[model samples]
Target: CIWALVITLLGYVLCSALNPKASLQYTFTPGHPFATGVEIDYLEPIEWLPQSHDQDRTLGAFWKYLAIVLSFAAARDWLMGASRQERRSGDGASRFPGDRMQWLLWTLAINAAAVSLVGMLQRLDGTQQLLWTFTNHINGGHGAFGPFPYRSSGAQYLNLMWPVTMGFWWVLRRRNVARRSTSHRSGGDPHVLLLVLAALTAAGVVVANSRGGFLLLVGLLVAVFVLMMLWSKRQVGFKLGVLAAMLAVLGVGGWLGGEALMARFRSEDIGSMSGRKLIYEDAARMAEDFAVLGSGAETFAPLYYFYRKKDPAWNGYVHDDYLETRITFGTVGFVIILLIFLAVWLVPFVGNGIPAPPEFFLLIGVAMVGILIHAKFDLPFQIYSIHHQFVLLCAVLTSLKWQRG
Candidate 1:
């Protein structure tokens, strides 16, 4: 299941960036197979939504998320029974440092680096692999962006990895410093590799030319600083070192690609109802009308058309995830969403002797905070890669527990 989710995300990112738009379609025709020949096995689950998703792509995303949920159930069961299996199977040694959880983190960090590298190349090489490569079909542009239609989407998607990359980088750095006379993990020289990946991820975000992404990156670093001061006060020098390393990476990255970013920021209208701001105002009105229980999942685009009178552009997303949640899920649904998904991060800190490393959960929590911050400014959830990465992070963090058969 872990692999299924990972491949699913990577495939979407790849297809979105390079494949012809028509090539990645998963038919909703009930019995048809995906373009990749895999059977379409998830229509029923997605159909359970209050209203059918208006588009095939959106419906496909819903199915993928449902698959992740089912996979999570299987993973939880396995975690519960892992102890029994360990006692019966060979190798009773404890699983720590380089276990599945750690490797998963590494996978995410590496995957992020790869994604950033592709985007960087796309920008520098002046190539467009797919139709609507840089310009969202809604908007048109000639320049190369990342795997996304808009540079901001690509930037924010990469920005979502800020915590994961930094977290893994820090973990490996600690491991290298400890040099644990007896190695508990399988990875060797991971610290340097991780540091490189972290730099790549940050550089990618910075070059995407997204003001919001830049703000999110800054916010994440501040979060790391606070976490360090409150929890790992002894690591003062380490924190400073990480900060300096990050600064150097960003300085170089900014030097290479920051002119476009500066131009983008300077070009924004200070007092104007750009389409997004207009949509936001209407979404706020929709939220008030549906304040108790949101209109419904997947209903935003269709319903937004009615509310948005000024532009009447039929915008597909609300631009702000928090507002979208409130408008779709309503107040009750919004709170439930938080409790179900976010509660895991809080549970570890709620108790002492969590058995799991607080740092692991702390990193996950910090990453999540980055998600919320980004969500506030734009609907990161509208992008499959951004949304699924968050789910994957939560699952990995939640699985790191004392639960045993």
Candidate 2:
């Protein structure tokens, strides 16, 4: 977990250091599996970096370092686990190791601890004061910008994780309910508590003020409720109504605070939209020019700086995950990367029988929704903390296996 968190933070730091404007066009590299028919370039130096404290990519280096450290820890743990299992059973390599999910949960706990530490570090150094200067320029002043140089991005990242955690808890409660339903032990209070907590979590989701996150949650809940109704689950309709109430409360609160939910959408300013059209146009044009193999891994920032005629703010990333993957990994790398996410999201539904547990679908559903949501407005996979959550979600979902034996 400690390692995972480090990876997560460092990944964010590294990604943020690159040209954010060029975010989508920068990922393709030459000579790898995806490099077929593609040309490549190596990483080059930049002449002028973005001076807007909020736009600087120094954090990208931090994220890169964190990912390296966590990778080491995961490798070490895998080896040790393999050794221990071998002592107990010769086929340990082929069999499930002792409490794989528990070990992963330990890693996740580490991630939470590490993130809290980083959050504290930012607070102590007064990074928020510096980052807030950009807040006036971002999202129409209605968003909750953090105290860092990358306030909005950081806050959005953290807020998205809240739902992922809550969804996991929902899965846990559901599994317990399934196991105990036959006994009629009146495990009612705990179930009630779970619903209450889930409601509060849904409320937090809304207060995030991120249209992407809010919409993702709404879509997820709708799907979950529909499935529940179809399955004839008792009281699920009421539970969904409560969830609706939570959203209403958040909307009303946002309005009263003068930060209405629609504020994010009202930013019709092309520049305010992060200059997305220009960025996307440039990325698409460049990718086609260098089709097959990409310019190279992490080479887009310098190229963008060189070729850019108007937008001096060009960063390496393209902002959208699908586009980033496409430009970075080319077609082959793009497909494989997408398959990873698809497999993670869809496997549970495929293998699980009819009338799947609400928890099973909801966890995967909300998580994918969060990933897809975050993907559109920001490039999170490049961030270590966000990536850590991805891996942790995969580990947590393993618990849904139908039988221990």
Candidate 3:
């Protein structure tokens, strides 16, 4: 299942490299018909009678569908393919996922370094056009960071890496502490490397200067801190010490970049959240228009204009993912989407393998929740890397080992 997910991941990455942003032709005037360039109508009667489909397969569209199919297939396999070995592995040391997690973490760490380097060069040179081919004007604003042309996508991609490293760090640390040191069964510490990687990713987020990304990062830090403080199996004194250390790290980061961070928040106008609320308002009307069936899957851009207000020339995503999904898929689709999320979120606790230390499962659960929270404020799904990354993470979460403690 993981292999299937990874293959699809590579497929998306290559597809995205070939065609970035992928929504160019969706730009159209109000009352204009939705673009249906490649118009295959891939799976017509197979879907609901009135359900809509993609506008074109030009930009990363195929990747989206392919990734979804593979991911869901993997998820299905994971849920039904549970083995006796897995059920009894209450120590939370599932070989497949554990090895796969380490490999993916290192791969992401390398990617982070490359992205940070590119972003640094772009920032130093003050040239957003260096990575022009990879980004659209909308995402190409401040600086094109790494694979993504948009700062928000880059930040979100980097943000997702945090949980992978942190989860393993906790798992390995527990394993090491539980076993004898002289046993020579090494479950070495990933803290120093993962921490450095996280710092670099956070710096990239700051350098990208995405308001929502910045907010999400801050929220993530707090969430992780609170989780560690409250849920960690470490002694109380150790937990307090961890808290003090994290506070100092935050204080230093704020002190170093206080002005620029403040500027991002201050640059906004009063009561204005990047005009997202306005988009949501428009999306609400669209959701009503197509209450049962949706406007279409990727039809939001063209369909949005028709439902949009006269002023403010905006030609991009609705920004809010839930609202966007609601508007795109309508009420029925929205309900189904909500149910799927709830089902996955409950996997760890409901019937998942008995966690070695229960909180370990909770850590992974938090990672999933973080993305869901991030999705509410911005279009992380639109970003190339993050879109597929979410699919892969979903598969991982679904297949994770659960046991009777």
Largest TM-score belongs to which candidate?
1
Checking candidate 1 for backbone clashes, the offending pairs are: 294-329, 294-330
Per-residue lDDT, model 3, residue 252, is 47
Writing each residue's lDDT as its tens digit, candidate 3 over 258-278 gives 566678688755266767777
Candidate 1 off by > 4 Å: 1-64, 74-93, 128-138, 141-144, 176-188, 229-240, 349-354, 402-405
Query: Which is better, 1 or 2, measured by TM-score?
Result: 1
Candidate 3 residues lying further than 4 Å off, grouped into runs, are: 1-48, 53-63, 71-97, 109-117, 130-136, 182-191, 233-257, 268-270, 349-357
Using all chains and alpha carbons, the TM-scores for the candidates as numbered come to 0.74, 0.58, 0.73
Q: lDDT per residue, candidate 1, 3-46, as tens digits?
A: 44344433432232222111122225454321212122213222
Candidate with best lDDT: 1
Q: How many residue pairs in model 3 have overlapping backbones?
A: 5
lDDT of 2 by residue, 1-405 (tens): 333433443443344355343322223456332221222333432423221112223344444545545554464345234345456767533222234433553344334434433443434344333343443323333333343233335434544453444444454555556566643245453334434444443444444445555566566556655644454457564456445645653554344322534666576652545576667767776667445433434445555555455455546567776666555445644554455456544444454312334544455555556676777776766666566666655534432433221
